[model samples]
Target: MNDIAKHPLAMDGKDPSNLRGDPIDPERYYSRSFMEKEWQQLWTRIWHIAGREQQLAEPGDFIVHDFMKESVIVVKQTDGSLKGFYNVCIHRSQRLVWQDNSQKSFACPYHGWVWGLDGVLEDCPDRGDFPQGDPVGKLKLSKVRVQTWGGMVWYTMDDEGPDLLTYLAPTAELYKNHQFERTVRVNWLRVALNTNWKFWSDNFNESYHTRTVHPQVPPIIDQDHFTSRYEMFPMGHNRIIQMGRPSLRDRLPDGVPHPFDDALRAWDIDPDSYPDFETKAMQGWLDLKAAKKKLWKEKGFLHYEHLDDEELTESPFQVLFPNVAIAPGADSFLVWRWEPHPTDPEKCYFDQWTMAYPIEGQAEFVNRTAVNPLRLVEAELDFREYDNGAGVQEYSDQVVFQDWQLTAGQTAGWRSRGYRDPYFAAQETRVRRFHEVLNDYIAGNPPGR
Candidate 1:
């Protein structure tokens, strides 16, 4: 057989590929030190998306997120600015906020010490009788670094990590002309799973698993035209290659509204309401053209092209390494950030947020326009469960539940004596590139460039 048939993703001078080989070493994964390093060195330093600006809409609104073992409280100040802090009370390390919502201020159930929305100490139980003479003035809730990007809240434990924009890099530009600041509906979580954080990310970085793991995703995306590319950024950050489906230029369903073309007519879309509709719609048109070219190259038929280019590019999926994955569709975008749990080897939190463009001008239509990418469309076949030689977990629920069992199963197998390192194929470049960065970080390579 030819080399292409024999070795998919073959590279020169590297060790033999690890395609369909032994599993990765479980010991490296289960090592206490590895987990601890992740907590101290990685988790604390990395910028992780916690929630969106809409979640902290009101001045006193706050959202409490449990990151690893760290409790993060994202609160909107009276000035309409947002701040993030460790949810622990400055006094006795007690949790300051139990739930997420608008409150005048955060009060510690432990000692009744309260902090303002800005995370400043604002009240104490009794100041006159204290032996330390009012420790309140000296103590304020410890603040964590926070920044908002693409209308989402992101934080880091280290005050010295890269700036939020710098950290997100080229990925941040993905939604540049889409008016993302106005689209802020999302659901996020910081799951605690025993498996390595990389496991979930690796699974997301490659589309090869889609056909088997996410049966529906494959039909939505053109797999035969698939190609995976990688770009390394400074500070050990990376972006992976995920192109639009070849069928994107295909004709839309008959009689559907041509939002892009309609805007150019005498009935112009209101700029105030549409914001960046022109740019976004133009992008959709261009994407549709790219999609049509892709389909014609691989498939011998002409697909519908009524939609704009922006619609074309916005519907595909891509991954931004270390944490975020973007799965965009016609109706909405699914954004996920994976966080390592504080104290569990068997657990990590997966925070997923969904963003949809609000149908402009019509207030009532806004709510109706909000879309969720993961919501199961009733018409499709849902083989929601997978058997990995273990008892099943749930029935036709969602692809996520399906992956939960497999990821957890892989975590369990990591400890097996027969387990060995995986040999990756060239087609699995994204996975291998991810591991390269992961190993480099673990090995204490000098950062920058």
Candidate 2:
């Protein structure tokens, strides 16, 4: 593994000294009171991804991000800037926008109050009938703090919360090389799962279950803990940088076609040239990095120019505090965001977005997890329920589907009397650290203010 100490802002996430060793209580996952506390303290205070900035390209284009019982609207202004507001009419608290679309102005269905693109009250009926002053040009929609980062529009309900960049900190700085804004969202899917939102937070913070749950991942993106670098930032985000090559310990049966071999051959390297599996896994990985660095520009991989050798060949899976997990690669970016259900602590919505940079000749992008060949375009929203694996039957082969299948069982396990505090491995320190951070938020003290 590379020397993580050489990188700025990189802390040993696997080190127990970085954490408080807080017991991950079971109630945090399934209790109604704890869910309410999280809704008030954590979810509302943290920066939330409303939608991709690409969704709001033109003026007056907006996307409504409904979280729990609250809805927020992120819209593009006439001045070529983005603004966010609570998706409620100022007069009667009626929801102004029901879905994402472009419009000249927001009109309340209940009261006929028209709000302009700038969020000001443009017009209202019966101007002289109100006891107060004229509603037009005086009343404005309530605003939320909005910011853009990594091609996504983010808004926070808390006025005193940290700024987006400050909250993101080294994470935003680490990904400054990749032009995430230029990538197209090839897949936008939401799956309703019967599990707490914390299930995703815990699942993503550790890769210990990858070998058992996502067996296909080890062969493609080395899941060996010793080979990966674990980094936890003070800003409540954690990242695991895994080698993009196959794990030396995980070898497919002899004569089986290897995905790593195909990856090497795609970059003009011969996988068979290596004498053994270990050599092929290790040396082939180095060769792939060299191949990418040497031929990136000629092969139309323009996004790789600013990336370092490690960034070009490694998979950095980042878990932004609480809900968002992003796996950014040289060519493709996979993002997963989990949100709590409106009324059920045992149910949550999960979003998976596959984004890829447009190559000169490549017309489609195949995501590693889903393996779905998607066209290079902004896809429409797709919502599904994990109805015993029937609703999204096509996604049954996905890594997330495997995880979804375990959610119900895990949720039941959490509520079991036999359940006890998690006995975490050193590599799984981030899982406990995530809970400690949640404790911080619940105790009215979150990191970065």
Candidate that would win on lDDT: 2
Worst 10 residues of 1 by lDDT: 1-10
TM-score of each: 0.70, 0.98
After superposition, candidate 1 runs with Cα above 4 Å error: 1-24, 130-133, 136-138, 184-195, 225-232, 235-311, 314-316, 328-330, 360-398, 443-449
In model 2, state the lDDT of residue 413.
96
TM-score of candidate 2 against the unseen true structure? 0.98
Query: What digit string (tens of lDDT, one per residue) describes model 1 on residues 171-232?
Result: 56544544555543533323334566667777875556656775544323434323334334
lDDT of 2: 0.89
lDDT, each prediction: 0.56, 0.89
lDDT of 2 by residue, 1-449 (tens): 66645347767988989887888889888899999999888888999999888888899899999999999999999899998999999798999988999999999999899999889999989999989788899888999999999998999999998899999887777888899988988888998988999999999999999999998889999988988999888877999999999987899999999999989998999888999889999899989989999999899999998998888888899999989999989898889999999999999999999999999998888876664888888888899887988988988888988888889899999998998899989999999888888899999999986
| Maximum-TM-score candidate | 2
Which residue pairs collide, candidate 2?
none
